[model samples]
Target chain A: MSELAMHEIDRLKENLAERAAAEGLIDVSYRLVDSPVGQLMLAATGRGIVRVAFAAEDFDAVLDSLAEKVGVRVLHRAAPLDAAAMQLDEYFAHARTGFELNLDHRLSSGYRLEVQLALPRIEYGHTASYKAMAAVTGRPAAVRAVGTACATNPLPILVPCHRVLRSDGSLGGYLGGLDAKRALLSLEQDPFGN
Target chain B: MRLHGVKMKTNPPFELVVREHGPAVLRMCTALLRPGPDAQDAWSETFLAALRAYPGLEPGANVQAWLITIARRKAIDSLRARHPVPVDSLPEQAAPIDGFGPDGLFENAGLWDALGTLTELQRKVIGYHYLLGFPYAEIPGFLGGSAASLRRAAADGIKSLRKLLDVSEES
Candidate 1:
């Protein structure tokens, strides 16, 4: 009934993936990340983590957007994202307080990109007002711009954009919706916030 | 951003497609290419190539046929690069995969060695019929014969194989 042993063929596919990575044929590799917030689509270019998408963002649309913005060559190979996935799990477990991986903000631009760049500096378990975030981006008058920046933050949790709030100390708009905002903010305050 | 009504057709999840059809493609390659290492290389390249372009495949397309088409092309590539086909020897099968059936078509154990006695066309016809189960109606486009002739070709090929294999054992 069979002329081929599938296990050997599966081993060949693994070798093919590693060889593809080694040959630099991969433009962007991605994997779905499970977190306290929700399912996230994490994509990375050779540079770094390029995009982190909320489940509501529609994984297929996010991937298509990525294929358009990044190179068309993309695949689901979890190997490259293992370290980042581990850090995310630890962050959710309150065992970690910082993301040490490099980032690629190719999907963001102008004031938004500037805001995204400044987000990681907000510190863990702390909140910064929109005015404060705008100030950090050197556009103190761009408070609304700061809110837009947070709303459009591509790499949300990893970039610490959740730490930005309203000028009145209220949780502001989050790309992943308000409940996810609360979960993340509360998760940060836990002593497990290692 | 939400993309509810995008009108373009894209491939289904590429990983799912790969897992679902990989073994079938591998069997096709093994049946066509005969030699083990060559078959493995062809199988690897086939999926690697598929992964490269899978995102562009149409949603309603026949996935099995598409994969089989690619597998066949890779097998042909291996076939062409293979300098001289194995006219003798085991061609690396060594033992039949999953062992010979109870029907004694493979009782003597050197199936691949017997396969080496077959002509390339005979082997291809026999494999497409018996190993992969592609209907004879669809094979003439690739193998160049009517469905009846293709079936006869397969039958004749297997008859030649039994004679070749049985004589070897008696000797």
Candidate 2:
């Protein structure tokens, strides 16, 4: 603990802090998509998509939460999301229909999983009633349970929970709002028609 | 969001936790591995693994230390896979991260260099206590060492780092 030694530790701390900040910035980047709902920001690590936020969501809070959960400092930039955003853009444009990126599905499980798992089967230009999904999940009588699952789905669009409808063929519920679901269903009917 | 074993917090969203602490875990990976592209790979793998195992993370837990533990194991495995030597016989020099200045003493480089020379136990101790900003009390649970042992290890590691850097500067 000599003066020089202390100074060195101080220097190391400062250097470490600076490097951490720089690295965090370099590691995190976001892509914005003009979805039918609103602007969607996809935050990605070098490996894959880490977060997706709606336009009304608080960006800083979202970034902070992602960093804390993933145990990495989140750098806010417009770079890493280029690939994911592009894919989403294609999706929104109806040019591309599905995501090929690695997704961090840690935020979802249980009923959410059951619902998400059923989404792909809903097919393009097709929809299933909530009761139908419950039946598919072997909960043939748990139609209300299926509705809850759709409401809790973490990967909304990618999982295509919008395809779940009310037993009467009405749109049941969607995290992105019913209007967004309606728009998505419309787009699926006519990729270029939207 | 709502991880399986974790409780919902009215205080903050979980994504913020990932953003703030992710770099510390990455830094620990770089420190454990030799600097270079492989370190980056290890870091990526660590996060991917973390994402897969995220549901098990308990709320009010020390996420930074938890992540460091996982990353350390992954780094060791990555090192073992790339090298044919027995785990104990694996040379520190085998996975040298390219372009890293000696001991990471250079300001232009990342902190990984300085961390490379320490024993694995020391690295984890210091990583948990200092870089990731964990309290001394939490070190015992995260590292499975006694509180006193953890403190001593961190102190000794800091001393060792200073000495290592000193030697590097002189050379």
Which candidate comes out best when scored by TM-score?
1
Q: What TM-score is obtained for chain B in each of the predicted models? A: 0.49, 0.48
For candidate 2, give the DockQ. Answer: 0.05
Among the numbered candidates, top DockQ falls to 1
Candidate 1 lDDT, tens digit per residue, B1-171? 223344444544554555666665665576577657877888888888877766567655666656755765666556546544322321221122222231232223366557657888788876655544455665575666698988887777777876775544233
lDDT of 1 by residue, A45-79 (tens): 89899988899888877876776667556667788
TM-score of 2: 0.46
After superposition, which runs of candidate 1 have C-alpha atoms over 4 Å from their true positions?
A: A1-13, B1-40, B50-70, B80-123, B126-151, B155-171
Chain A TM-score, cand. 1:
0.89
Q: Model 1 clash pairs?
A: A94-A192
Per-prediction DockQ: 0.16, 0.05
For model 1, report DockQ.
0.16
Lowest summed lDDT across 10 adjacent residues in model 2 chain B is found at B89-98
